[model samples]
Target chain A: MSDSTKVRYLEGHKGPTVEIPTPEGVPLRFTVASGGDRAGAFLLDAFLIIMAVIVCGIVITALMVIDSATASSLAFVLIFGFRNFYFSGLEILWRGRTVGKRMIGLQVIDRSGKPLRVEAIFARNLTREIEVFLPLTILLAGDELIPNLPPWGRLISLLWVMGFIFFPLFNKQRLRVGDLVAGTMVVQAPRRTLLPDLVEEPAEEVASGEMARFAFTREQLDSYGIYELQVLEKILREPKTPAETLLAVSERIAKKIGYTGEMYPSLEFLSEFYRAQRAYLEGRMLMGDKRADKSVAPQAGKPRALQTKLSGKERSRAKPSASAEPLQWRTPEDPPQAASQAGDPAGPRVPPVPVVPPAPPTPPADEV
Target chain B: MSEIALKSTQFRQEREKRWRELERLVTQVEKRGIRSLTADELHDLPVLYRGVISSLSVARSISLDRNVLEYLEGLAVRSYFVVYSPRRRPGEVVIEYLTHSFPQAVRDLKVWVALSMAVTVVGFLAAYGMTLSNLDNYDLFVSPDYSAGRNPSSTREELRAVLMNEGEKVESQSLGVFATFLFTHNAQIGLLCYALGAVPLLLVGLLLIQNGLILGAFAALHEQKGLSVELWSWLLPHGVTELLAVMLCGGAGFAVGMAAIFPGRRTRLESMVVAGRRAGVIAIGCVGMFFIAALIEGFFRQLVNDLTIRYSVALITGLFWIYYFGWVGRKARPA
Candidate 1:
């Protein structure tokens, strides 16, 4: 690998950076995307909640009007079950991406940056039953029963709740136990470039003088045609590149074009050009990860991996990766052989009972 | 771009950021339920997202091309007045606070009225008993020094003639002047009863009760003397505005005391502050009532020497004023 490419790759390994590119001279600054767009999600959730409440209200009213104790109790349970089923089912099925998340450009993916599959989604969402729902139910019932406890059971439950509730904070990735067990991560949807590449029709005559002076190489320009070239450009144009190297690259490009002028194309421009060219040769397209290997042959010692290697700490920290292999959540046909193996009888053996209560519509007053 | 367009664009950008942040929050909530967030995390969400939106708005505003400033100003104003304006719908906190208690503020007000009415009934019966027994006449229910007369019916008539002749210029300089001479003198006693509420509520009620008792005695005496029509003429002219004022003042005072006594979540002092704000508004309303009473006394009462005209005018204006200020005023446009 060229020393320049080595320098380029090293920059990317450092830390998170904005990859979105805008026109030159336009100030590219951090802009908060609208949380309001997610207002719809809140609204959608709220609508569902309101509907549920209204339905429950009507049912309660009807029951009261008729004075049916048994019917009222049944109705209450049914409503509770319905809410849990939909809320948990949607979250798991969609891999943490709710209707709201989808509306607002977000998704849930696994650690490897892949959409969460069914098993992971189920595992993560099902925990809602034990961690949130059951605890609340038990607490309500417990309070009703003991009237007053020795404070031990209450304390234990309180600690268990307090401990689990704040679980997301301790981890950098913000994973709770469900997230950890399910191997999931919530991520912002990768934004697509607004402008597509301009097809370079045979130019009539390169605009005279300064314009033609820094004309991009055919291969270099072609990088812009592919979406992934922007990523490569982002990686290449780093502050760490020596000024001398940039000047040298600029000189080479200028010399090839046979131009001379009072001003020279900036080293940043040249570095970006080379980066784009290299990316084009590698055949990586925008947002396409699998095709990355075929496009660019990995030069020995370059470690041209799709992404930076996991940090040493991360690798060591990962609890012996519960293998990527799918665990059985019963398909209609695949009944468990015995409940032996993982000893997780909490699996397919327990016929799926409704877990979460139907989510009440999000209140408009809530900041959430 | 025109200034409005520029502002609109800026608003749009800020809105977009909020949407993005909300999207992020929802994802977080989905991955982890709301209970899972630490208090700090929960707190941070609003603060961070608010910061992000503000920063974006500032950036967009600064970046705006000056050419569009005027247009942007217009858009901002329009949006301020029209779009993005807060709905007047009752908020959850307010609704819950108002409804949660079984005996609401309005209900309590009714209880006060009932108590005042009871006081009036008992006062008249006591005065009647004194007259029937021919006791050393305690007719007007005031100390002999304050009493203008034991003949309540003719006393009322004489008071009316005095009001007509002297008009607004004739208020007694003494404190008792308001309770005694004014009580049977003008039918506007009702308006005074309601209006005095603008003061600390205790004063308003004391004035109302004092007036009600004296009037009860006077009316009972008038029945004994067989000069009820003469008393009615004297009482009706400005009494409507007076009575309405008293009730409104009572309502205002009740509001203040209630706020002080049961300040949910607020310190008693804080509740007093809120109640004070509401009282200030009601006081402003009382000023108008006072003016109306003064008008009836100065001009209308002078012309309507006939008892019938005075009574009818008082009755109509009294009812209308009471309905308007008491019920309608609650729904008045918030300043």
Candidate 2:
């Protein structure tokens, strides 16, 4: 697939990642390093190399006063070695990282996810001599290399070199000629530590039984699935989320789920809802009944069979009891049958079954 | 709800120690080389890597905590590179390259090498015939700066003197500097030939042919003065190695160019990568050849004036190279 489409697809699901399947069938996802970071790393490495060459020149000049012959030969070999082998040698020894890459928190990795090899490293760095250093030298010594070169010739040469320099900008992966030829890519190497679980945080108000202030029926809870739960969890976890945004989101979710109870202090209501939804989803997951999203029809054999059996027995019993008593609060400890019985007294409860006969559309419940 | 809470939290509690240990070792290896780790730590590295990888898989499936999942992924990637990167020592790598990789690479490109040799020879013959027919064509083939003092207008004695180490003082100290300079200069030219191979075939061919034209024109200039024998002695000792080095580079360039143009069954990029890799090995070996040539040109040719010794040295070098590239590494499978 073209990179643009790939990026759009990834953005729809998650971030851009390089997925490498391991022998154990588990695919590992690594975030691709940004082009800006790669360019910064390259500039840093180039600066280091130039500084090294300059220091070597100064030392050799000092040695020239002692023995001109030895100093000249040493200068040639040292400068040549520094120019040619600095990146390759360090990468070989350090395992796919040079000094700049380490500092910038980037690394070269095989595109196919194989172990980086010596020949691959050599191929990549050798291309640098052509892709970067050669063009640079040509630009710097254009008159010396080609005597009496015209301005137009220089401009063409400049454009040619610039094409090579900006090559990575044209690709989604930000791969230069070296990376393409070597079948490698640079990636971010972030160091991270696990943070405390968001779920484990004490819900003191909910624990004190104030969660009963917002009661959701089985159908309302079933309206969303794990994907929506995760999105809600993200919003809840982000410290930067605005209070107004939380209130608006809670209002929208309340409307969708048909919850008419008071939701003053929307954060607490959302948090309590997050907990109940998570518990519901995890409970289903334990029974091998994973609900990927709201669109997925409930699983075929087990849950459907149970729901059909319950709907046959409870359909008559639920309608008669619905309008007979005032709405009752259901605690976290209440069973599903008990919670369903405590549904709103003003309207008939929606049966907790996959298949339901058509009924008159219920009006938007009055704000209680 | 209770089961999930217990499962995720307790699962982390059970494995967090090992994960942290692995992270510590990985961080150590990243800061220093693998040698910084103790032997026990070394044994544990791969085992812990596998553990973290498995943890990442499990966490991805069950954990809703994005921080935990992200942390495991980052840790797994870092440890993966450290554990799997090639660890062969420098000495072993050098020995392997010299004994197998270099010669095998050269042999693989033999067809292109022959083609490169033919192009240079055609240029040589054309230039030789032209210079012989008319001495005025020498200036066209050979540039003024490159000709130094020896040209068509120079007398026979002056041309002969250019061939011999006469009428010029040779400082022993400067020879070292001269050899170093020639080595770097020739190596750069070889690398340029290989680099240009990626651009177009015509460019590489032109460079090779231009080198041949200069040599052919100079040979004709000496031939007209009846100093062919002296010129041959002066040039052959170093020329055999130097010319072969240039041809190897040209051949490598040809391989790259052909890979780009034809590509056979593979895509153009894929073909170029394969060719570029093999060509890189040849390009590296050519630098050594240029070094040898530079030594001979700067020292041995200047020190040894006897015609017999120079011819013998040149013949021996030719035979050695023929045997080295053709037969030395053929008996062993490439590494």
Candidate 3:
């Protein structure tokens, strides 16, 4: 297979199981998996950049106030010492990313897809200083102090400069000394999909055909029920899986569920299944599983307006009686009763508490 | 058989195509976003994005290193002063002041050369003209002390002997100083002449004329003396080198003066500046000759005092230097 084909295969199999091929060798399109928002990262980057510029300005002004020779020497030391620091501090501290990768919305992650190891971060930063910055800076500084020293000083300085400037020529990661020592890689930040709450409408572009290419068929996609699919779809969009191979398992389960058609289960479905399947595997299926039915009930028949709030006029209340049943059903008017039942011990473990903010009212087109 | 062969060829082609695609894909992923490519794309990423990937790849090479920045800086400063004539900025008051003072140096050199020649000429004229007019007055003009010391002879012969021996007793001790002075003075004059470009041409022309007259008078005086050979012998050993040095200096000064007054296409200051650099070369050459003159004066002239022998030696030395300088100067194209 061609290289692009290999890339396409990974895109197809990974995460939320987006089929993602556009068509016939065109731009490879995949359903977007759930990813993290970068507003925080952007703010951090801006802060770091401001700090570096101000510090550099202060140094430059101070150096200028001294003799020309001394000023030049200072410039040499600072340039060599701090070029890598700027990139490293900004990458690891403020934005939690490197400028090069950040500009493109990428983040560096470990093999396990966790935040970078501090040691690796510092090592990489140090290496950049060692290979390019330090040697060249020393040469730059040395010549100014002892100009009459033999050509040896000059020759070494030249070699150092050449090595650094041409560093990009031979690096696979476009990394100089720092990158080599650190053993880190730059990768794009995965994009996020905004999922509305139960009463709200779905986002306009769900990238339907992309998720269908995974192992599951269309019936399994719909059969999984809209709420599971909706939650699963939202989960698929998360940038990192935290755990690997979730998509493959989801596809296998989706295939076993009597789903036979073109549309496959999305990352959204897999993540929800991953959570709910844990309960099922641990023998926590409710009698008839009617509670799961209730959570997904209001989403049926009208997927478009799922973003909207359910009206208060229709309401119901169900008392939680201590009964061990495989499943129980709740009417559309009794969402709170289902919610209370879901909180029970035998039920799928609810998240400790909802950390995500409640869905806001749909704003005017311009406001959002 | 043909079908089998065709199938195998197709398979080979497919494999090769895959490999190339893979390389390109890797390269692309490295430079741009890896997410920009699909999983299928990444397998061939190295091949497709070779440039990008290789750029990221760190390779090592060995070679000689040079500090180009410092080298350029040194060249700029040294060459600016040594090879090029210094110039004040256009409309700078300094240029005007330099121009006014520029001729003084050249004029001073011219005056010294003229004064020496004047003494020689007046001595000769006094001897020659007085004898022609009246024998008795010849003693008063040439000086009774002059021939009193010479072997009894004609007024011209007596004057020639006096001129030949003039400064002879002090010659050995003063030879070094004289030679050095000649070398330094001539070199300095050449520099001044070249540098005077900041001033008017008239001053340089006057300097050249004055030096030329001095030389003429000095030579005519030798002819007036009956012992012309003796006089030539005494002076020629080093005089030729010394004269050449003076003339070259005068030429440089004249060049500068003319450049200042009659700058064509270039501003007066600019032309004078250009001439100054070229003139420096000539001035340096003049200094080298002065050193040769000093050598001759200190050792050669002092060692040989026989009237006939000294004349021949002086004549040969004079002719040799004159011919050499003229030939070399002709060949050298001044900037």
Candidate number achieving the greatest lDDT relative to the actual structure: 2
Sorted by lDDT (best first), the order is 2, 1, 3
lDDT of 1 at B323: 58
TM-score of chain B of each: 0.49, 0.92, 0.46
What's model 1's lDDT at A135?
51
**Residue-by-residue lDDT tens digits, candidate 3, B161-198:** 45555444653544554445544445444444433322
Give the residue spans of candidate 3 off by over 4 A. Answer: A1-368, B1-163, B166-174, B185-198, B212-225, B307-315, B322-335
Top candidate (DockQ): 2
lDDT (10s digit) by residue, model 2, range B1-335: 11224244455777889999999998898787778988778877877777788787766545545567778999888787777654556788788888888889999999999988988898888888899889899999997888997889999999777678886878888899989988888887887788778766898899999988988898888899888999999999999999899999899989988988899999887887788778878888898999999999989987888999999999999999999898877776644
Weakest lDDT window of 10 consecutive positions for candidate 1 chain B = B76-85
Q: What's the lDDT for residue A7 in model 1?
A: 41
Sorting all predicted structures by TM-score, with the top scorer first, yields 2, 1, 3
Let me know the TM-score candidate 3 reaches against the reference structure: 0.27
Docking class of 3: incorrect
lDDT (Cα) of model 3 = 0.40
Candidate 2: the clashing residue pairs are none
